[model samples]
Target chain A: MADKVLIYSRFPKTMMARFAERFELLDTGGKPAQDVFSGNELAGIRALLTAGGSPLGAEAMDRLPKLGAIVCYGTGYDGVDLKAAAARKIAVGHSPGANAASVADIAMTLMLAATRRILIADQYVRSGDWASSRQSPMMRPQAGMPGRRIGVYGMGEIGRKIAARCAAFEAEVGYFSRTKHDLPYQYFPSLEALSDWCSVLMIAVRAGAETQHVVNADILKRLGEDGYVVNISRGSVIDEKALVAALSDKTIAGAGLDVYQEEPHAPDALTVLPNVVLSPHIGGHTLDSHVAMQNCVLANLTAFFAGRPLPHAVKTA
Target chain B: MADKVLIYSRFPKTMMARFAERFELLDTGGKPAQDVFSGNELAGIRALLTAGGSPLGAEAMDRLPKLGAIVCYGTGYDGVDLKAAAARKIAVGHSPGANAASVADIAMTLMLAATRRILIADQYVRSGDWASSRQSPMMRPQAGMPGRRIGVYGMGEIGRKIAARCAAFEAEVGYFSRTKHDLPYQYFPSLEALSDWCSVLMIAVRAGAETQHVVNADILKRLGEDGYVVNISRGSVIDEKALVAALSDKTIAGAGLDVYQEEPHAPDALTVLPNVVLSPHIGGHTLDSHVAMQNCVLANLTAFFAGRPLPHAVKTA
Candidate 1:
């Protein structure tokens, strides 16, 4: 008999197909646990798979009396209540670094797109403005990557990758994290210091209470008029209102964003901005990233069902 | 008094301001030389400034009998009839490698944007498709850059820079050039072989009669269904009609083009395509690149008037 794993998030059928082959999944269809499953059914579930961003609280964990594992499908587990899980003795596991390269790739994509004003250029060509020889203010020459300073907000897997890529473009790389690692990049003690020194600030920090809205109006002001921000991390890291204001009044040159304060929906102000380049939250959404993450999820689940420690368990303080 | 220098090509007033300070520029306002200037005015012009892509055939050269030097304002001098210039003992000069970094940056921008389907993602967010949780075929997870094969068609300055940037993203780099240099990348013997080996083909070859329409139907076919091509070089290098056919039929995945067979006019067929990311020959249009090219032009012109060898003269066999 296959081990029953509760799917607490609504994932596309295609993404769940492989897992379905290995486990009997009791899907909640993105609803409350009690709404979709009876007390008996919920009590019998031993493990659950969830998107890293979905809210999973202690109360929900209590419904599954037999739940021993909480497996997150991506690098992040921000929405998982770590204290609650720990009190319940639930082993929290996540696919750490599985999506780092892909996320870093998106960061570079967004950075290049925003800095070079590629979206504006594309529109200029598509609208026949180029053929007609029409002039555009946005068509003004932009500074290239060489000699540009790129400040990274976090120095984790994705941050490190971003730094390496920026360095390759002949740009100077700097970072501000909780602790400095022995890397080639310059280390800053604070985000403000990093922002002041670099022209482009890349947000790659983990989303949490400490990081939420850390990049506020002050930071944007420090970034100055010629600076740009590229966020591939959680959108909550930036104060969206401040970003909108910065972009609007030219406090900052522009922004390229993949994540937002609200997922799936970016603000109307941001979408309508000519200088900004916005994309659906897809930093870690590559095929290779998905496969790597799934492999980790499968490994964690298999180990949990076997009454063993999770092979990819997240270390919590 | 400033030496007479004919402005043979139409440039924006701002771009010409610095040149005007040093030369007695007879601006034609993009009109035919005969229409804009009298024979006497044309005869006095000993040196001229031109855009690298504008036509400067033997007939145009013949009109300026005292034309001792032809200074191209950018890296390319393809517009100049080299044979005619050599026969007339006219020294041809250009800003060699002046815009290489900027052009390479654009190439990377286009490659990342097309491969990641960034435009579609941007639209998904802006159009509220993401908020509705609507699925898009274009939203399917894409292959990231790491370990991906990038074939560079030219091993010049721009090509080398592109390879370095791609390598920093952890992509496998390969190349095919007329003469192989001691570079770190794998060198293929021909463009066909390089296309066969790599998924992304970057065209950076010089544009001339010998290389006209080099990337045709057969080459695009070789690139295969999952392949992408990016051209920062001149457009005559690729057969546009064949490219349209290949893209329409999904013979190749997509293309990122900065130049076209016709200047200032991209084909309606190309502009309408979703897979192609088009720019209006803005590869080397960065302010830094312009300043670099102008400096080279200044040096070339100053040397020409001083009866010294053109400092940045293009050697003719």
Candidate 2:
């Protein structure tokens, strides 16, 4: 019999179809009516196709006794309890850096939207307001991207790509990573220092207990009246309430946010603000990104089924 | 006595104040009231502080017999009859290459907005539709900028800056210019060929009788179903009616436009289209641009009064 695989989350239809060809595909196919199967169904599951922030903690891991590998669809795998999976000798694999360019590109998109007031400008023309006045409602002049100081909070793949794009726009790119690197970007040791130094602060860190609410009221306030914030990472990385207050109160000039504290439900506070550019967390959903991610998951799955080391294996330590 | 200067359009109050320090000031000051003076008043007008497409053509030039220079605020003097100005020995001045960075930044902004469906994304969140569905209304996956071919219709300073910015994003930049330069970008001599070769076509050429409506239905249709168009140049460069038909019929993918065929009056056809990102003609209206344009006009005026070659004199021939 083909080895049974638990599809813990939805994969691209093509990927799911391809997986079914090689293994017995089971579990919920993105149906909210049923997410996890009974203990008996998962008991003999040898592998699982999943995504970052999945519900694959100790409880789910305890049920899947035959599972040898958990292949995550996208980069962040914080939901998988690596320590527990390691104790059970189950390797975890994820598509790392697969969507960095897409996410970074979105970050820049948000930056331009907010800074240039494109949202308001579009509305102004659409609403027939421009007919009455040639000048757009007295917006602060956008000095363009060049020569502006851009500070990235997490200098990972996404952050690095953002920095690279910023440099191309002739911006002064800097980062506050955990450890200093020899890269040309100016390094700041702490978030506060980076916030203080740059005109724009980008949040691109992973979401976890340690990083929860890393950007709070104080950071937003420190970013100051002229500063701009753009977050393309996990929504939880920023304190939504604080962000709302900052934008509302003009503590910061504006924001471009793809993710929010709640999925699907954008905060009421941010929804009403004119200075912020809000999206429904579409950082890595590009056509190219989805294809890359699927290829990564398939690589890990194929490597594992053949009794080889999984590509992109996440270290348990 | 200060040389009389007709303020044909509104400049920033600060620029006006500074100009007052140097010369006699005049205008309706952005009011909708009468701008042109009586024929008796026009006879003494020595210079005019105006912008592109102002009513300072041969008729107005004929009226202002004493006018030696028509100082345009920003580039693009197509509205002025250069041959007539040459016949009359009336010099023209415009701030060249002043707002290229800002306009290119906006072009990229509209490209991202149209491809990523950012305008709809923003509306989805604001309309509370996202709360009902986590997935944004099914959109064709936007391929990120990198490796995508960006074609330019004009290879002027603005086009060069745009290509440089695109290269930074890892896009393959090419252009269709009348004269080929030995630059890194691939050069196509014909608009149709460039449209066929590129995923994104940028309209950045100047507007004139010869160049008006250059991007007609044939050019847009050549761009095909997968192509995107971004225009930061004169709206007359595009055939507004043909573009509307193409967009309505899905002959082309999408468009990001800052200029329209008529100022302040957005085309009713484009207003309802979902695949377009529209902005009123505000591409070069930034604060920095205003300052630079004022400086150019001032430089020309100062040089003209001082009897030096007008610093940015437009060649009549």
Candidate 3:
């Protein structure tokens, strides 16, 4: 008999089909499977497939008498209820570093877009503002990436990848971490010093309460008028109000934001500002990444069913 | 007494002071110096300063009988009447390879922007299309640079620099030139073969009658639906009509265009396309590049006045 797996989100079609072969997959994209789950179907589910955004609360945990494992299909397990999972003694696993390459790609893309004034240039061509016979209307030259000093706020997997790409552009790379790694780049013990030393700062730290508002008005001021900030990490890491003020006052040159304090709703101030490039919090949501996440979920469920330690077990407590 | 030099276009402010020290300068920006030139002020004009777009015609060449040299500030002296200058035994010098670094930067920028769908992604965030709490709307993962094959249409200075940048991103690099250079990348004798082999093709050849519309419907078809085209060279290099049709029909995935077919006006066909990224041909217009251009102009004039061989002298006729 196949062990039942309750799915809380949709995955790549192929991977979902693969999961169906291993276990009887229950579909619940918007909400939990309510109708069948209220009966014996709920009792049969021994594992849950969740994502970074889908949490398994204690209330729901109490109803699943046989639930033993929770598999998350993204680098971040931010939405997972760690305490609840710990109380129920359920194994939790998440795909770690699966989307680092794609996320790193966006970091550089956003960096170049903001600095190059890509939006303005695109708008310039579309608006028919260029004189037919004259030289293309001269716009400000970009503060290009080459030779620019870049500071990475965190030196984990994604941060390391970002540094590597920036270095390839001939930009000097630096990092701010508790302790330095075995990298050739310069390291600063404090974030403030790193901001002062670098013109472009890339955020790639782990998200948690401790890291909230880590980059605030003072840090923005230290970044100065020629400095640019790129955040691919959690939105709460930056105080959005302070960032807006800094952008408005020219305390910093510009910013490239992939994450926002208010997801989906970027502050209106950012829309009007010509120097910033904004994207919906999709630093890692590539199709390649989506497929990778599904594969990770499969590996986790397979390991759990075979009475083996989860390959990427996330510490619950 | 200093020899006279006719300044055809505006140069950087500091460079003007540098020129003032070397020669008696004459400014004729909008139209030719009609009144002054007809006067004896043009009598000692030993040299003329010309740029890529601002040409000195046979008529103007005849007026400056004493002209011994033509110093161009940009890399391409496409506009200067080479045959006319040759007839009078005039020394023509242009800044070659001064723009390689900056132009290479834009090529990669366009490559990433178009493939990543950056402009559309930026618009999506601004348009409030992403769901606030759910996973940010899934976007197609760009056929990212890593592990992808990139074909350079011309193996010139700018093309070599672009290949280096792409290799850093882990993309496999190839090239198509009249003849292959001593490069590690795979080389094709024909553009069609190169197009079929690579997913992304960057055009960087010199503009002339022989190269016009080199990438037309046939090349686009060979590149196929997954292919992307990026042009950083002359606008006339690619067939705009064929490019638009390919983009419209999804025959080619996308394009990143820095130059256009019609001087300053981009076709409306390109404007409505979601997959194309357009810029007003400012690839090498950085302030740093401007300073470099001034330095080159100064070098040519300095070498000419000293009766030494011109540093970047272009062969005329």
Of the candidates shown, which would achieve the greatest DockQ relative to the real structure? 1
Task: Flag the better candidate by DockQ, 1 or 2.
Answer: 1
Top model by lDDT, which number? 1
Per-residue accuracy of model 3 over A145-218 as CA lDDT, tens digit each: 66789999998788998888788777899999878899989999999999999988899897765788989998
lDDT of 2 by residue, A146-241 (tens): 678899989888888888888877789889978887788999999999998998998888777788898999998888887899998878788888
| Candidates ranked by TM-score | 1, 2, 3
* C-alpha positional error of residue B282 in candidate 2 after TM-score superposition, expressed in Å: 2.3
Between prediction 1 and prediction 2, the one with superior lDDT is 1
Residue lDDT tens for model 1, A78-159: 8899999999899999999999999999999999989888888888989999878798989988888888999999999999
lDDT of each: 0.91, 0.81, 0.81
Q: Considering TM-score, which of the candidate structures 1 and 2 is the better prediction for this target?
A: 1
Grade the docking of candidate 3.
medium
Residue A140 of model 2 has an lDDT of 42
Go through the candidates in order and give each one's DockQ: 0.82, 0.69, 0.58
lDDT of 3 by residue, B1-317 (tens): 88778887644344467778878888775357665466577766888787665557788887777888999877877667888888888889988888777788888889988888888788777766654333333255555666788999998888898888888777899999987799989989899999999989999887666888989999999898889999999888899999999999999999999988765679999988889998887787666666677788889998988898788898543
Worst 10 residues of 1 chain A by lDDT: A9-18
Report how far residue A103 has shifted in candidate 2, in Å: 1.4
